[model samples]
Target: MESMLIEKSVQGDVESFEKLIVKYNRYVYNIAFRMMGNEEDAKDMSQETLIKAFKAIGQFKMESNFSTWLYRITINVCKDELRKRKETVLSYDAPLNEDEVTLKDTLKDETYNPLLIYEKLELRSSIENALNQLSEDSKSVVILKDIMGYSYEEIGAILEIPIGTVRSRLNRSRTTLKNILQIQLSEN
Candidate 1:
């Protein structure tokens, strides 16, 4: 079913493309959120990735996984945005927006234990903080393989690196995150 969508999308069928979006939007948003750290930037990056993917759909290889291809675009779009943000300055005087929402906000379930929820949220927040400390390459590998559950081979295809490189980078990324997290836990 997905392969059919991919074929039709490549052939410029808009309805097929929209169907594809329905299947992959969540995955794209997840990657973007992990890469960009905040809700607004993640949504922006995800939108850019979708636009780029739509433009380049004709170039995608049918044998490759659609999720893998979309993930690559998401990462590249994020990397570009990071580069742009690195050079841009933020004004401390700028007003703060009170309406910012997060994925955590949407997952509210009164049935869940409040204590369990607090602990999980704290742990996730710590991990995300640690992840932000990693270099982009290391962060990408960790997010792809560990957080998003992509196989090492899929990560290689998404990042355009060798499998061995993926393994090494993931190892180093994990080590750094572990160290950072330990420090956080110790401090707490």
Candidate 2:
């Protein structure tokens, strides 16, 4: 079914292209959100990625799966955005008072106790802070493997790097994240 959509899209069928976009929109936006760390930037990056993909669809070869190809495009778009921003530090601190319910809490089940929700929020913030400390390459590897659940081979293909490099980068990223989290926990 998707292959047919891709074929029609490649042939310049606007409806087919819209269908394809509808199917993968959330997937692309999620990657963008994780990489960019904000809704505005993620939306911009995702929009740009889909536009570029649509323009280049006619040139796309069928060797790789459509999702993989889209991923490659999304990564490149994000990398470009990151470069333009040139911002190093990402602030994870919530501006609201301590007692205020966070956005994370709203998304989670309401049955949980407030204390448990706060604890989870802290953990999530700590992890995000640690992730922000990593270099872009290391961060991408960790997000792709650990967060997005891509296979090592898939990661390598998406990043255009060797599988061995993916493994080593992932190992180093995990170690760095673990050490950072430990330090955060000890301080708290």
Candidate 3:
């Protein structure tokens, strides 16, 4: 189905392209949100990414998956946006709004203890804070690998670097994150 949509969109079918956009819209927006850390900026970047992808569809070789190419475009768009607003960091907070119930609430009958759940959530928030301290390059590599679960080769293609470079970046980023995590742990 995705292949057919890509083919039809490439063949100038507007509806097909629109369908593809709708299908991947949330996925794109999530990546942008992780990179930008704001809903408005994420929406703007996501729109820009789709527009750029549509404009460049003719050049897409299909040597890799369409989603991979689209993800690469999304990452590039986020990088460009990050460049203009370098070194900005978001203050990490527990997602404790009414719409977002605590992990304890979600774990109703689970075997996991409530204290453990709270601790894990706090740890996750701390990791996110440490991530905010990283350089954009390191943050991008970490998010693409650890959060989004992209393989090293895919990351290389997306970042337009060699797989070895991606591996090294991931290693360095993880090391930095681990050190930060340790500091946070000791301080707590």
**Judged by lDDT, which candidate is best?**
1
- lDDT per residue (tens digit) for residues 61-84 in model 3: 867877778888998898887888
Instruction: For candidate 3, report its TM-score.
Output: 0.74
Error of 2 at 111 (Å): 28
Name the weakest run of 10 consecutive residues (lDDT summed) in model 2: 89-98
Instruction: Assess the local accuracy of residue 33 in candidate 2 as a C-alpha lDDT between 0 and 100.
Output: 78
- Cα RMSD, each candidate: 10.1, 8.6, 8.8
List, residue by residue over 20-75, the lDDT tens digit for candidate 1. Answer: 88878998998889888888989989998998898899898888878888889999
Clashing pairs in 1: none
lDDT tens per residue, model 2, 1-188:
87788889887788988888797798789888778877898899999999899889987778888888898899889888887878774222212123443333444554445334447878888888777666567778888887889999999998999999999888877876655555555456
Q: Rank the candidates by lDDT, best first.
A: 1, 2, 3
TM-score for each model? 0.77, 0.77, 0.74
The reply for model 2, stretches above 4 Å from the true place, is 89-118, 183-188
